[model samples]
Target: MNAHHDHTGPHGASPSGDALPTGTTGFTDEPQITLRGPAELADALPYTLGFHPTDSVVLLALHGERGRFGGRLRLGIPRSPREWAPVAEQLAECLVEGCERRGSRPDGIVVFLCQDPGEGESGRRVMERLRPFAQKLRTACGALDVPVYEALCLSGGRFWSYCCPDSDCCPPDGTALAPPGTSVMAAAAAYAGIHVRGSLRDMEARLRPRTARATVIGQERALDAASAALVHRILDTRARKDVRDDTIRLARMLVDRLAEHPPLADQDTSDTRDDALITHEEAAELIVGLQDRRTRDRAAEWMEGPEADHALRLWRALARRCVGAYGEHAAAPLTLAGWVAWSTADEPSARVALGLALEADPEYVFARLLHQACNEQLDPETLRECLRGEREARAQAGTRHAPGTRATARAAGARGVRRRLRARVGRSRGTAQGAPSTGPGSARPAEASGPGVGAHTGRRTGRQEPCGTRDGGPGGDPSGAGGADGSEEGSAR
Candidate 1:
């Protein structure tokens, strides 16, 4: 969580009592795949789970051949759910694909580097995104027949970067370099500096093909516990001279030990909410139970099979695990299982999952990363320029148009149009004309005017005109020739 460390997690912690986890795996980012070829896939028992042994310990293998083999570390960056939201989505997609190709889900995935170096807060936002990602892989992989049987969160961040990389044993590009998710994916692949001595069984064929396998160290007790829960009591009495019946019978039986049976919580049936369908406990429980390759594969199938509709729900449920410190993000486990689905199978559901994550927590960087990464992929330079232009335009517009100015603009435009119309009408109606006539029944201005009449200067009354009459109005003079022989209105016209 500190964003700079090589070892500091319950996961992948050293067997020794050292406060900081230290192992030969070394604090370094390794290329996910340095080996990819027909031979690699062909020799790999093609979908077989791999285990690697070192110093009387074990690590998971990404790919395999007939017996077992190992592959490079598939690493990625942990971005703020807000800062890297859309990009995070894209990153998830890439990781999912990469995992599938690995022929196994990630033996473990580090979703985010603990921001709190002392305490990683794999918070709700983080796990919310992760849970569905895992469930989706399981569901889609089932259809492909490419199975990822075992998966779990492997080792978490180590405060490796804080140390001087110049130190002979210091990790390369791990704690010292940029976070693995973004930079490593963007760059070419590189192997971890810590060399590995692979376990080779001397089973010789003319073509001694090889692949990678991993066995988790220190997690055996937990894994074995899960294994017992998963392994059902199946009786195959018909076969087996070499395989003894009830090997359990040979061992001493403890009368007091009772089988633990956690009740299966019924899934929600209504399905009305916009949130993910699965409960947090459900996703965690499913992930916890998936301790081995076979179980892992089964979980994946459960996701895609008849339970496909619940895939989103399951993801949502699992993501809730991130609320506490131990799960800040559910990346460790989901990443481990998703590798095989990523590389070998196509996962549309998983790819679309970023949107769901953002919906759950828009401010989360993991969600934002989806859109950003996607748009950048479309055209990075163009999008940047466009974004800048849009920002500037918005800034300028803010000054020119105050809030509520929309109504003002409309009013002003309307008023101006009305004024122009009024002026045009006034001009057509003749405003510059002099006061003209008084007729038989109307008051008139003093004027002497006829059909081809005179000017309106100093005219006192219509009676001044030739045809003006007293009956016209008081303003008219009785004997005035204002309209002497013509109708007053005609004269004015």
Candidate 2:
């Protein structure tokens, strides 16, 4: 359903003078549109979320007397009715507490249960089935002292309201939603350059592992070869810095390649083309190398401007390459994908990717910290500024070393070691010197230890550090080789 603006109100304000809900940056100077009733609210869901949610329970916080929208939370609906009560309580607590942390306790809440009916089931039946769940949600919110203003069930292109009892306006039979792009909200969104980014499932599919048997097998084999070739060297202290440098360099090169080749109009075709650009060997080596927290943070520097756009696509492609036993290794790339998405103001994609990262490895400290910050609606610039400062310090340090100085000699020695390792990897993979490898057995020339290795050398137990420390390099670790603080250190494999 779509919402039409009642033009009687002046300056894009509602009849009550409330403005449209703003994002993380707060209200903007752009004109606001007001929505009235369940039909209009259902129509505004996709635009509010930046995507259409399927099989989801969405709770939106509304503040003040004008019912201005605030933070929102969404989760997949539990399949079992027995699971509804506990899930409802958790969702209610999460939303209310989260809003409080942001310094805005919700004045009221709006609930939306969106799902499609099963075969031979009607929209009315779907509404009836979800009725108890809706009541549980309202009851949970009311217990927190924030009442649910409205509860809506959207299914089969129709909407049913539980708060409104009148049959004339809120009929027993569900009301059909307005046609797509036909509402006043749609027109205002268009004029303001706001576009709905399709469905959540569709956005997530782009980052999932390849399903083709051949592709999966090839990637798995490549990962195995890379793990065997690089894990030991990565664990060695002398070689760790070189490995980090190589990983960052290769990632930059790949980002440039993606930037040069723009995405096609069709998303599927664009993903396929992106997949083709990086060979199985390249993807596997990068994935394995990125298990290093320092390496991952260095790669994260490409989170803005033209480079960020391509870097995000590269991260997504890399995430898709984590297959078989190497699936846990995807935490690095997926976290990077989430960071770039958040930096670019794509909160929906960031949340999905970060969620997947935690699923891959729940103990991933970087992912945990990033996920929490994103959820709190903290501006990503805080992290970005920290990264930028680290990058500049590294640059200045390199320039400080003069010709034939001790630092220069050490830098040259590191490069020579990297060259020797590349040669060794090439010989092991049976590839010619100085040529890119293509076979599944072929691996990236330079490699380092995974995140499981050397990550907590100088870190204190049970303490979590931010993304980057003001004085140290990435991971906020002075040693610059361990995972984020509080993470267990071990072998990546």
Candidate 3:
């Protein structure tokens, strides 16, 4: 994870036998501190990933003689023994080849196998069980000519090194890990204002499926009611403009409300306040209303300034409300959450939200595109610029005929309004004109010619009523199929 090098000297004896200090720094401008042994490295893992990695394999790429850390990759440890080799090989190839692509081949690699002990099992036993997998990893990297500098197993509050042979330091029972925040690395990180939030599990919990059955049932019911009420308004061709404009207006109102009550510093309090501020019914209505692609795209304009943070909080709160049978309905809110997080430079949360979005609906086009962009490490500014340009264009067009004599003004305003409407219709039609629909309800669009994020939108057909409707009746299964991740039911996918 360290992206920079330092000239700091080690004050203590390095871990005996090939456990050289990881004398590398990350994206910070501060001087690097040295990690002498398994203990320090174990402590450094959280700092590296911004959260403690659990049941994961972390590969640290070491460059040159000083072993300056280069790139780092982490993946959930494969549970099946048969799959370990392939995963190891893939990890090795990705880190090694990826480094080479950037003009430097890693001279060495450091591997950390982190897993907690099962009930009644000791840390040593966990380490023993993972020995083969660690070996596979080392061998995989070695095959690419990048020797594993150190291979360590961290479990049961202790660490065991497979590469270090010094029994005094890396004992057979494993070395007790240094207490958190006591290491030189921790001190340096603190000096730089870098804080490791908590375990990855803790961070992900905020976005995970809530299992409170009653709450989920209520939200599902609300969703069903919202769907029943809004489906016709959203799909009726004659009312399309009104519906679209209303969706946008409601979205703006919510953003303004969120802006008035920004999140408090205490996360739990902030979340509670957010959930309380927006009612279940209101949240459900907006969630269903956002199914329109155009509506969601228009709302995406709330990307920066004070409104952006509040907007992000709103999306997150909505995401949390997407419970149980309404899980797939999370796609829109989750995508918006991810987009705002990414726009705000919170990559970890962005990746987590976007990944969960895919889990909710694998075929969700916006989620897929955002996930791909995030994984590829594309600059968020690229997408931000596109959105900003679109917003600016819209603003300029709105004011293009602001001033004139009353009669002339009326004519110009009418003509200007017509021009804008035509432009909007043309853009929508151009994107979806002849594209085939997906399944029974969804439609696909060609990529927009102008710069934008998603190449296609998933548009559900107007012919079918929203999922909760049965035989054209309002009363149907509350736990029915639908989505609220980003846009309209019949939007371009």
Candidate 4:
């Protein structure tokens, strides 16, 4: 999620994060906030401290010549990574000072940490800062025999616990939604009730004029590359089934007449793959860029590893997308089974390859799209019903799926909901000779309505049982007798 590091600056929010670009800064006279040396601790802090999940860490640099609680300050932000060395160093110094002032040395310091509006879109500087901090947290805790564990592991159940006990998290709306565990970052943020704040593009407005001045700070090229890559990847997935994806064609049309060549073509095709819509290299690359190095490496290896289940999932996703894109144009021989086999067409085959890629790496979103296709096919009522069970479904997907954590918690909270429904089914069943069940995964217990043993005593004829027990169960009168003519099932029908 993307949210600027806010602070006690605007709207009672804490203004944290790198300054926004000073669009059209006239008379550029301020010594262009350059690093003073090859690279020192102060220089690297801004960039390095950006690594934690957003809101987990905050980076602030206290600067000034006379210690007047001020200086030409530049808060580290997602955009700070371009000139990461200098910003990272400054941020580290700040964190170090914070800890040292309290008679302690920081294991690591992050420049800034903030939400980036959507999943994994935390500020670049936040992630950069966190990269070193996580390592430091791990190293320091492990070395000191401090019973090291992720903040999530400890903070859970005790939602109010926090490293910055003195500082306020987002304005508390309610109690913590998540307990601490492996996902300490998310747990902490959730505890803060901090939803993704501000739009990614709008994040600039959140910064102070002083900090906003850094928006145009030498990151044009990197941002261009990042933006292009991100936008293209997103549009490319429009080919998935049922999607009216005009992104690819529209994108091609937009740039076809441009003087510029496709930079991606020249940059590095080694990581990009053709034929298949997705690739192991691409999967790993996304992981590296979006997640951590260890996670990236692990994902890369899994993309090529053996796992039939993973392969099947990928295949399903790709097939759905290919069919969606091909629409009425899909022409291919079916398998002997006469069912559509995925590995037949360019798009579908790509799905097949994607599935293979997933055998090694299962978290590929495009692959995940296949399942989305299935989800889309559901009716609104059925879909809502499925979402009612989203937690259980996600949990069944297992620990490999981090997104499932919340979903699972939600499901666990609703434990035994089906039992209540089963009780209703049993009640209704007692009223009919045998009645349809409403319980999950349980078939209706109704017997086939045979014409021989009983006549149709439905309200159609207003001739249900006239007497005996209630409905047409064993103790009840036979159909066409007593209350049987006016039985609940008959009335319902």
Best by lDDT: 2
What range of 10 consecutive residues in model 1 has the weakest lDDT sum? 446-455
Q: What C-alpha lDDT do the candidate models reach, one value each?
A: 0.25, 0.67, 0.61, 0.24
Which run of 10 residues does model 2 get worst, by summed lDDT? 445-454
Score candidate 4 by lDDT: 0.24
Q: How close is candidate 3 to the true structure, as a TM-score?
A: 0.73
By TM-score, how accurate is candidate 2?
Answer: 0.77
lDDT of 4 by residue, 317-404 (tens): 2222222112111111011000112211122222223222222223332222221211111111221232235334435656555665
**lDDT, residue 193, candidate 3:** 75
- Model 2: per-residue lDDT, tens digit, 360-430? 76556666556655554445765666567556646756777665454344333232332332232222221
Candidate 3 per-residue lDDT over residues 109-153, each given as its tens digit: 778888889899999999999999999998999898878867889
Model 3 deviation from native, Cα RMSD in Å: 11.9
How many angstroms is residue 232 displaced in model 3 relative to the true structure, after the best TM-score fit?
Answer: 5.6
Q: Name the candidate, 1 or 3, with the larger lDDT value.
A: 3
Task: Find the 10 residues in a row with the least total lDDT in model 3.
Answer: 446-455
**lDDT score, candidate 2:** 0.67
